[model samples]
Target: MLPLWQLTVAEAAAAMDRGDMSAVDLCEAYLARIGALNDGLGAFLTVSADLARIQAAQADARRAAGERGPLLGIPYALKDLFVTAGLRTTAGSRMLADYVPPYDATVYRRLQVAGAVLLGKLNMDEFAMGSSNEFSAYGAVRNPWDRERVAGGSSGGSAAAVAAGLCAFSLGTDTGGSIRLPASFCGVTGFKPSYGRVSRYGMVAFASSLDQAGTLTRTARDAALVMGAIAGQDPLDATSADKVVEGYAAGLSGRLDGLRVGLAIPEAGDAEQAQLLTDARRILEAAGATVEDVRATADEALIVPTYVVLVTAEASANLARYDGIRYGHHVPGDDLAAMLGAGRGQGFGAEVRRRILMGTYVLASGYQDAYYGQACRVRELVRRRLEATLSPEGGLDLIVGPTTAGPAFPLGAKLTDPVAMYRNDIYTIPANLAGLPAISVPAGFSAGPAGPLPLGLQIVGRRWAEATVLRAADAFQARDDSWRRRPVMATSAASA
Candidate 1:
């Protein structure tokens, strides 16, 4: 059996059910792992050890009472953006560094009901603005594979935590590519459901339309199990879909016969990436699935620009509530304008402030029509184009491609180049723009100077077809073991 902390969500759950370990035992194992590894990973912003123990005890009690919940006794963490009643929720920003939510996020509430233990809060980019996670006010989350490389943005800590075995899995929010990018870099499975499939209530709003809650886990099956707990209609969130949730894990029939996987654009990066694609194709084809190139007519170049304009405009509105006059980091001044200005200037990090300014500019009177409006139109076009491409009539079951241009880059390599950093998300932004369900599974790895850096193959399905996405990823993972690779940090922590 694997170490308690290193077990996947499903494995740990089954272990506890077999009486091999108790909920408290599992929780303690994860807490100990986090204690040993979090300092170097920067994956967790707050370790709720006491809360975890309490929850673990409760889960044990429930299990003793014969409540057979899938997540019962399993330990996991949330990106700091998720609100936890009575727990500090920082959103990786000074603006809410000391803020404790009075209510729990809908997703967190559901997971709690499922009997999952809350290990802690994971770090993220402040206000979910950056692509490399360096904009995290708390600090950058280092790649577990290579300590000097980034773990990808926004959900960096979520992926890093899972990769380092700090937690079994972590919840992350993806606006553009936050969850998938980090998952790809960290060599974990990242699953982003179709927009509105999962409730966003109680989460710190980034770009409301684009923001979707997802998971980072060691395997696609773990992601499926977690999604089962978190995905459903929410009365609190009007945007949440009213569709019924499928038995995601059960949907993994392991039958890929006649499946049509489309090769999406941006081509491949290096020979390593190209080889990864070729291997992925071979694997899919060997499974009785057909892999073919998809000729997309929409200008892929507009995806990033359109996403930036729309999300920034939404961010400008969402973050306006953080004015110090209410709550947050306050800076006093003689006048109202000065007070608001000073407080925001000091509260938000550079990236957040820059985004706010750019968002504000786009939404301004005359510029609104030219930038934000056009972006919205383009977003609609992207949605229609993608939907059309994935329609049953289009003969494409899923879209497949590399999640990132390459493996994780060294930290600070693209910090000064926002364009390059933004481009890193080029392969991923289209999904969020089109509100499709996407999963990034560990494709393989490329040798870097420091260690083996992972690559990812993304599977994007029709909107609200998270079941298909998970099932396909599950099939691929069953055929390969790349998803099982652990980084040096995790291995060292296990030995320790």
Candidate 2:
């Protein structure tokens, strides 16, 4: 039998429903695992052990009354970026280390209603700025497969926690590849729903326009389960789309017959990405999908520049609230100006400060039209190109590609170079730019001292098409056995 902590939420729910296990017992097992592993992994900023037990007890009561939802009795963690009522939502920033929100995010409240047991808050890049988790003020999150390498970022802690069985699943946010990249590195499933599909009401702003809350889980089916619960329109967020959410779990068994899968490679992807894409294509073909090599129409290059301008412009406006007088870090002193200046300067990490500076510069009076304006027009054009390509009349069910350029690199390797680090997100960033639904599933691996690191396949669907994306990911996952297995780290072999 697989370790209880390693079991997917579906399996755990079924077990609980069968009376084979108690919610309290399962919760304790994961709590113990987090206690044992988190010191080395640095996956969580805070673990809510007391609140978890109480929630578990409540779940047990609900089960006794014969009530259950997909996530009932399942222990999960939040990417510290999501506010949890009364729980410290640091967003991995020293600026908000002791700051606890008075209320929960819409998604958090929904998950609670679905009966999920909240374990704690996972670590992340401060303000979700960096591509690597090293930007976290707390510490970097280590990959479970190879401790020396990163687990990808800003949701690295969420992915690492799920990979190491510290939590059965985790909530992560992706502004630009944060969810998918980490899921690729950690060997799990991560899904970013269509913008406005999942409410962003209480998620701390990184770049409000681009930020999206998603799930990192052991399986695509588990992702479907989680997304089904939390996805909906919210009165709190005006941007929340009022679209009807389908049964994402039910879509897991969707047929692949007559499905058109687009392979977005201009001159073919790089060797590593090509191999991952090739493997993914074969899986799709075996599942009855028609794989076609689609041309990029010269508009693909605009995705990054357009996304950066839009996101940074929003970041500049959204982050103005952190001026020491509001709910963030404040230096104690009689002079208000000195306190605000020192607090902000000392609180934000290098990457966050860099982004703020860049945002301020671009939004300045003279450059707004030249930089931010042109970017928005280009964004509309890119959006048009994507919609035209993925139209039902144009014969496309989903777009498939590599989740990242490669697997996770060493911890400090990409820190010195921001542009180089950002390149790691090339494949995954495009989906975020379009505000489309996307998922990453383990496609293969790369050899390493710990055996090999994970590779992932990304599936992109049209707006509010999470059900289709989940179905495709589930089919791909079902066709592969490699993702079912995990590397065994020998405790006897001590690290130098």
Candidate 3:
């Protein structure tokens, strides 16, 4: 018998296509693996074993009846932020622990239409507020490679599950660097489509303008398969692009032989980050790709500060609906005011409360221009600069750099310092700010002064250019078989 736990989505699909594996069988195998491993990792908030089996059986029937899609029968998981009708969709906050959505988000609905079998909901930082996944009310997700290290966040669970072979692939939302960062830490492939390329209608709003949904998978090819099924126009989402959804999977077979790859020269041998970028350039060049030195503009460096303003402002507004009155957590109190205050005060985590306060303060009467408004203008400038540099005449297929400043630090490494945690997103923030397609693929493992940990190289492209990004990523990985290796988690008790 084939080791179902070792199968990739593509491999599983081929098995199902050849009748060697049934969708129901694949789903059951995954559910068994998840059951065996998730308790140790805490990667999931909920497991839909029964539901998944039913969906898988239905997929088998469909395939039997000559119906199939690229992802049909593939068992996947969703970051809890994607609201699923009747399924408990907790955004890893106590506020929504028992709250069930009356409807599915467009992404969930579309995946269902694609005949994808959903295994369950994964954990995330509360309201997608933190980078460590430590802020989740459900507890942090442990890295599959090393249980002692975090799996990264807010999409940590999605990435962890895929990395651990618990799911074929998974969907995660990226605002700031949620998807790509987690994928980097977990040593998986994460693709964040150009903003608006995928519908955010059902995705819980974090930073609306910066929020995007993408896939965390084992390979760039698998990311393309999932992206193909999920990307398109939705009448419900005005922000969703109606542009052509080409065959992203087909584009993966294409090469970067004549393509130009941009290597952003970090200031001097700041050796830490500089070395990671240098290694990335070497891999890309070895794959028959051309490289050019490109400097990150001044606006790019301002992404961290700009993101704070825009994300907090939008989060504050988007989170306003969580008062005790509606569907979320409600505190039974003497009066309406007491109820709302108590519910919000107790339900929201410290980081969430902090951002909400900062957001409200910046958008308040006198501070708008000095803060939020100024941030928007800066964001616009940064976007324009990226567009100019990546235009056809700019001679760049994708921009390459380190995914994070470095690898996963020991737990509590940056917990006390918010700015330290924020700086971790430095290499990733520009993509979200510019509204472009970007991905983080495992480059290789690096041994720093401390110890060895995985490294990631980012490939960013112009808007709606996921194809180019994935192609280059695939090329780099092909040039290095070592990047495809998985981490071996030591024998340790799963974190509760």
Candidate whose TM-score is highest: 1
On residues 1-496, what C-alpha lDDT tens digit does candidate 2 reach at each position? Answer: 5568867899999999988898898899888888777888999889899999999999999999989777998999999998987898898988887898999999999989999999999999888877779999999999889999998899999999988888889999999889999998999899999888999999999887778999999898999899888999999999999999898898777458788999876464678777777777888998888999887432336766676677777876877778767778888889988988789888887888877888888889999999888887887787777888887877788888878767788889988987787667777777777789999999888887666889888889988889889889889888886568664543312210
- Model 3, range 234-318, lDDT digits (tens) per residue? 8999999989998887877545788788897655335666777777778777777898888954233587899999989999999
* TM-score-best of 1 and 2: 1
C-alpha root-mean-square deviation, each candidate: 1.4, 2.3, 2.5
| TM-scores, all models, native as reference | 0.98, 0.96, 0.95
lDDT (C-alpha) at residue 324 in model 2? 69
Residue 367, model 3: Cα distance from true site in angstroms: 0.6
Winner of 1 and 2 under lDDT? 1
Local distance difference test, each candidate: 0.89, 0.85, 0.84
- Write the residue-wise lDDT of candidate 1 on 1-496 in tens digits: 7777778888888888899999998888887788788888899999999999999999999999988977998999999999999999999999998999999999999999998999999989998888788998889999989889999988999999999888888999999999999999999999999999999999999899899999999998999899999999999999999999999998987768878889764543578767877888888887778889875322447988888888889999999999997799999788999899899999999988888888999999999999999998988988888888898988888998889888999999998877777778888898998999999999999889987999998999999889888988998998989998888774464534
| Global CA lDDT computed for model 2 | 0.85
lDDT of 1: 0.89
